[model samples]
Target: MTRSVALFATCLGDQLWPEVVEATVAVLERAGCRVTFDPAQTCCAQPAFNSGYHDEAKAVARAFVEVFERADAVVAPSGSCTAMVHRYPELFRDEPDWRARAEAVAHKAFELSAFLVRELGVVDLGARLSARVAWHDACHALRELGVHDEPRRLLRAVAGLELVELRTGESCCGFGGTFAVKFPELSTAMLDHKLSGLDDRVDVLSAVDSSCLMQMRGRLQRQGSRVRAMHLAEILASR
Candidate 1:
């Protein structure tokens, strides 16, 4: 039986990097899953939730649950958004109605790499990309979802791809949703620490979340760093 999956082409990936959305579909199709793009999807409402606006967050969460319930599973190319769906339930636990729905959705949401390895049984896409690359372990995906190894496993499977060790492998890019805007100086200081660790030997720095990449790229460009920001789906879709 062909498993059907819903694509959460998140707000960031949808607006900033449409190619990542396309690449995600390509990767899923290559793995033999029937992918459906739910145009009705919007921000996972993480910004609202993180800002302590549960009511506003629930409005979008309700729409998401309705749209994704039909699919056998929901797959997102973004680690942060997937993590939100998976982890946001705790925030709603005080409210019984939202808590149950949040639990049901969290159980179904899967990050791209996890979905590929666990649900689709795809070890690799037989993809080839020649570039020295490093990965950023976004806070939610790494700590919350325990997704540290899955992305690396898939990256290693790509022919000619080299995964380098970032000096502070577990450091945050400092994008923390509204955190960047609220404390720009502190955020940049943290980002500077993370970027200074890069050797510039890598041609691309890839992460599961675009928000992380965007912040990193801004600082890297300011310092004239040679590395370019890329998303994992973009790397996997590489020929």
Candidate 2:
């Protein structure tokens, strides 16, 4: 049976990182999975939820549940957004109707890396990118989602890739949605620590969420660092 998968490319990825979405589809197809893009998919409402707009978040969440209700699985390029979809149902625990919808959506969503490794079971996907690399663990992906190793597993499986450990591998880059705007000093301080860990040892930095990579790239560019930031999907699509 062909495993049908829905690609839930988040807003940033849809708007900016089309390559990531393309790579995500490429990897899944190469693994013999039938992937479809749900063009109606929107922001997973993480920004609204994190900003305390629960009602607006629920509207978006409900839309997603209704849209992808019949697909075999919903896969996303972002751990943060996927976690939001997976966990957003609990936000409406008091409302039985909305709560049920949230639970349905969450149960089907999967991070691209996690799905690639665990569900597809295809390692050594013929990816080839020769660069020293480090991974950033977004707050939602690390703490909320508990998805720490899948990306590394897939990265290591890439034929010509070298995955290096960041000095503080699990530290948050402080781009907690609005955290950077709310507390710029603390945000940069945290990112500075993350950037300092590079130490001429890596050529590229990758993460599941493009937001984190963009944030890191902004800081690295300001400091004139040559390290390139890429999404996990883009890296995996390498040949």
Off by over 4 Å in 1: none
Identify the runs in model 2 with alpha carbons over 4 angstroms from their true place: none
Which 10 consecutive positions of candidate 2 have the poorest summed lDDT? 138-147
Using Cα atoms with residue i matched to residue i, what is each candidate's TM-score against the true structure? 0.95, 0.96
For model 2, how big is the CA root-mean-square deviation? 1.3
lDDT for position 17 in model 2: 83
After the best TM-score superposition of candidate 1, give how far the Cα of residue 175 lies from its true spot, in angstroms: 0.8
Q: Report the C-alpha displacement of residue 125, candidate 1, in angstroms.
A: 0.5
What lDDT score goes with residue 163 in model 1?
Answer: 93
Encode model 1's per-residue lDDT on 1-239: one tens digit a residue: 57788899999889988998999999999888898987888888899988888889878877887777667788888788998888657877787887787788889999898889877778789889999998888888888878888889999999999998799779988889899999999999899888867776889999888889999998888878789998999999999
In Å, residue 165's CA in model 1 sits off its true spot by 1.0
Q: How close is candidate 1 to the true structure, as a TM-score?
A: 0.95
